[model samples]
Target chain A: MTHLKTKHRLLADKAMLWIVCLFATLTAVPLFAILGEVLLRGYDQLSWSFFTETTPTAYKAMKAIEAGEPIPGGIANGIIGTMIMLGMAAIVAVPTGILCGAFLAENPKNRFSQTVSYLTDLLQGTPSVIIGIVTYMWVVVPMKGYSAIAGSVALFVMMLPLIIRSTEETLKILPASLKEAGLALGGNRARVMLKVQLPAAFGGIFTGVLLAISRVIGETAPLMFTALGCSFIRFSIDKPISAVPLLIWEFFNDPNLQELIWGASLFLLLFVLTLNLTAKYLAKKWNQ
Target chain B: MESVKPILEFNKTCVSYTKQTMAVKYVSAAIDRNTITAIMGPSGCGKSTLLRAANLMHELYPNIRVDGEILLNGENILSMEPVDVRRRIGMVFQRPAPFPTMSITDNVLAGYALNGIRLSKAEREETVERCLKSVALWDEVKDVLNKKGTFLSGGQQQRLCIARALAMKPDVLLMDEPTSALDPIATAHIEKLMQELQKEVTILIVTHNMGQAMRISSKSMFMYLGELVEYGDTATMFSTPKDERTKAYLTGRMG
Candidate 1:
């Protein structure tokens, strides 16, 4: 009876292992499918002009289709606008988020800090669409028009909690001896944080910032409410701006420009993929 | 002959984590200058707590309360700013923690940097060489001064931590089980270093190793259950412990 039971348990263990492996493979199926589909559909449209030229107008796209020629322009306007907005949002969020995280880590038990920590969680959970609408009311209306500034404000709001959480967690996990050693050397709290704690946490915080940028890069709802999408490449922050995701949405809505959607999507997907992979690589390197 | 004043004194020093529990009971001791004193006890006996009180480390926690007087050069440190007190009293913890982000040379000068004291390029080099040499880590690390401190071996890292503390020229160096995490060979190296160090600064070391206390310290204090059980010369304490508890702990009968 005991021999029979042992054999049965071994069989169950093998079955469990197989089940886990099968589920793991199942989980990766959608990611590979998306990458494959986007690559297949988007490869032809990707060209030198696709990166340098502004989006072709609906009339122009229709004319190109009628003549059996490819679209004349690319998503240069969206690329530039995304870069500008992301840069602006990062400039504000990185420092503010790190400082807030440091405060939370240093005073884990303080009533005010506890409340701020709770608020950070709430802010992180707030939907991107809601943030877009809120930014629209707060920034776009006050400026009397949709602008890149408003779109960046929405992205900034989305990025802050992510950066703050990462910084706080990174700082917290550091051996208490490091901070104590700094303090024992007669350094004040602020100096210790700047000289020791923040430098030590650079990797985690940088990874967090990259992840935040990737997360907001494809946000169309927020941009729709704020930047509102522009056709021509423009540098002005106070004007309606285009983004890669915004261009893809525009392509989806317009029948004549439908062929351009996959190319724009592939660009956005590739950008996000690169950022995520770099962040992961850096995080692993930092651990070592 | 005129008697020299003690460099540090704890007059009824008490550390309480909460109202209900006192980690270190009112424990008073006087430390002579330029001598190594070891605080020895079993785990949870408050030897480490009493040493932490002298450095005002208890101040970092909101719930921890340190009462009575810790006098440095006859001034009450409890009333002084933590920064001012810590500068004069250096500390080394159980683990060898060299700042992972900083180079070995930078780690030596971290005290000055953290205090916002700018050093000339010449002065920076001199200080780093002087501190590392004092800890006997200069020759091994001089070629790789620009390398991160974490690149060093465990024993080297502990010595680097000591060098970092010594860079500030503190009057009293508090080492809380500094070699507890090190191997036997590394522990011996640090113990020897402490003997040479006592000529420059008063050393207060907390150790669980009775053999180490006898080997390095001129004076010894044995604490148990948050109270000082005995205080005397290391030789006398090891050979002729007065308190029943100290005798029990020294004999490995009580922990």
Candidate 2:
């Protein structure tokens, strides 16, 4: 009887494990579906022209649709614009964000630090569109125009909280002895933080920077209000620019150019995937 | 008879946490140069706090108040820059902590690197070799200078930490349970190194092991419940302690 009872319990455990496995499979099913659809629908859109040509105006795209011809345009400028905007964001945010993070980590118990920490979290929770609106009032109103710089300002606000929180968390998780050891060696607080503490937490900091970039790279709501979309190759930082996500958003609803949306979507997905993988690889490599 | 000035001195030194009573009560003591002084006590007896006060290592945390004077080389060390004090009086913790990101040679030179002091390639090489040799790790690590410090065994890592401290050429070295984490053989090696190191640098060690104190220390301090109970020459103090608490701690009768 005891042996039979044991067997029954093992059966229950096995059944529960299968249920968990089923849930896991369910979680992955949608991801595979999305990947499959993008690959199948978007592969036909890929060409030298698709990558290098500028986007056509919405009016021109509509005319092409009415004539039963495919839209003759690409996301080349959108890609470039996205790169430039995100590049400016990184440059503006990384140093300031990392410094804020160091301050939070160094003084975890101070009242002023606590206030700053709460404010950072509040900023993170604020919507990207809200950031766009704020940037518009601040930069667009002052400069009296939509500019790539304004788009970057919106994204820079987004990047700060991510970098700061990750850096603070990474530094916090380090053993207290590491800092003590450095201090005991007669190194000043500034030197210890820069040379010892920062290098030790580089893996996590790198992950944070990548995460911040990926998070803001795909943002379209903010870009719509600030960058306001460009139809041509935008070379000046003072002018408006279009990004891949915005291009996809504008073109996907048009029946003739749905494939272009998928193509841009695939490009953005690939870019994000590359960033995440690079982040993981670097974190693991530095950890070793 | 001429009296030699003690290398380090504590005058009515008291320490307390933010919410608690004193961790190290008003304690006064002196440590002579060219000798190993051992501090012995039971757990939570404030021995570690007293040891940390030597180089102001206790200042790392917030809301811990310290009152009174800690003098090094006849000057009040509390008045000096904290880094300068720490640089002059190097410290080793209870557990070995070699910076994981640094190579063995880099770990040895970390003090110099972190202090923004540049050394020539030959000087750096010579310093690393000399410090490692002093800690008896030169033969073991001579071939692996580029490898991470954590790649070594626990004992070897501890020695590497000591070498890192020694590379700074500090006037005094304070160790808190330096060998408590190692095996008996490793412990013996550390004891030997401390004995050899004292000829040039003053040494102060905190230990829980009574036998170790008996073996290596020329002077001993006994602490209990945040108070310095007794301090004197090791040989005389073991046989005839002035305080009852010290006698009880030394005897098998009580901790």
Candidate 3:
């Protein structure tokens, strides 16, 4: 009878292990596949000139081939435009998001704070496309054209809710005892929040901001409507901006543009991957 | 006892957490300056609440309402700014709660930093050394001042908290079961430290251990439920408690 029970337990354990393996593979395979495909297909087109030159005009490409020289179109302009827009979005979103998060976490019962939290929750659930449409109506239409500034506004809206929610959750996990310790040491509420509570939750808040930046950097749909597309290199916020994601989207539809699409897609993928890896490294270091 | 003025005087002070529930009711006592007064009670008694009320630390709880007066150095502490009251009255909790993110030196100087009062680097170092030495921790932690405060053993952490409290130079020190989290040897060390510290600052300690109260306290107040059952010199209170509840509590017959 004991031998039979042991056999039954062994079968159960083996079944559980297989089930776990199946679930792990199901979750991991698609991510690995996408990464593998991008690295394999994208590396072939990447070059110094591809990163440093502008998009090749139809006439310019034919002329370059006639001269038997490499094409001059690089992603330098797109990279600059993307960096500028993301920087502007971060400047607008980070402080506002963190302050709102702190207020919501610290004074959840305040009537105005509760209303703000409710609205933020609603906004967080709103689709990114809807945010793009709203930004087009409010910012792009008002300016009488699509511009980098409008793209930044749309991206800021998308980033704010994510940052606020993550920051609030991190702050909420901090113990009441830590706050009390600060207060008991002759510190007022503001002092306690700034010096003790915020510092304690800084690592989590930073990771949230980094994650939000990564989420927005690859966004194409919103920028398509808000910033439109421009081949010219322009750095002004009021001008039409060309970012890697929008460039990749435009190039992917043209059979003749397929090679450039892979290169731009690789740039976007590497940018986001670097951000995620940096955030993970920082979170681990700060946790210690 | 010397006839110097009391450092803290509780005049018919009553503390209630909710409108319907009272934690401490109409307790009156005078704590002499530079002396140790221990409050002894069972688990549910109001010893800790009373100590918290004396420092105005109870004000942090929204629903807690305190009536009557807590006079500190002739000023009504209840009427003072909680920050200022806390500056003059430092509290050490049951557990050793040094800010886990900070080093031992930083934890000791937290009071100054949190208050936005900047001191010279030399002065801050002097304060940390003096406070650590006062708590008999300097010799042990002198080489590792930059180590995390939470890295210390349970007993050492409690002493670090004491040093942190002392760095603020508060006039009155309130300890809520400060040594309860420590082992017997650590508790003995703390008790001896308390005796030495009582010559410089007034101390009000809430303890569940009757033996500890009898050992270290000059004055002992016994409580039952929410009321003060007996208040006298420790020797007199232990030998001849005026109330039956006090006698019952000390005899281990009733809580």
| Tens-place lDDT digits, model 1, residues B1-255 | 212799999999989988999888889999999999999998998989889888888889988999889899899999999999999999999998899999999999999999999999999999999999999999999999999999998999999999999999999999999999999999999999999999898999999899999999999999989998899899999999999999999999998
Q: How badly does each model clash, as a count of residue pairs?
A: 0, 0, 3
Q: Write the per-residue lDDT of candidate 3 for residues B124-164, one digit (tens) a residue.
A: 98999999999999999999999999899999999999888
- Chain A TM-score of model 1 comes to 0.98
Q: What tens digits encode model 3's per-residue C-alpha lDDT throughout A65-175?
A: 678765558777788888889999999899999988998998867799889888998988888888889999999998999999999999999999989998898889887
Specify the CAPRI tier of model 1.
high
Ranking by lDDT: 1, 2, 3
Better of 1 and 2 by DockQ: 1
Q: Model 1 over residues A1-288: C-alpha lDDT tens digits? A: 999999999999999999999999999999999999999999999999999999999999999999999988999999999999999999999999999999999999999999999999999999999999999999999999999999999999999999999999999988899999999999999999999999998998899889989998999898899999999988999999999999999999999999999999999999999999999999999988
Q: Model 3, retained fraction of real contacts?
A: 0.66
Best by lDDT: 1
Tell the DockQ for candidate 3.
Answer: 0.69
> Order of all candidates by TM-score, from best down to worst?
1, 2, 3
Could you say which candidate leads in TM-score? 1
Candidate 2 residues lying further than 4 Å off, grouped into runs, are: A1-19, A57-72, A253-255, B1-3, B239-244, B251-255
| DockQ per candidate, 2 decimals | 0.93, 0.78, 0.69
Docking class of 3: medium
In order, what fnat does every candidate score? Answer: 0.95, 0.80, 0.66
Candidate 1 error regions (>4 Å): B1-3
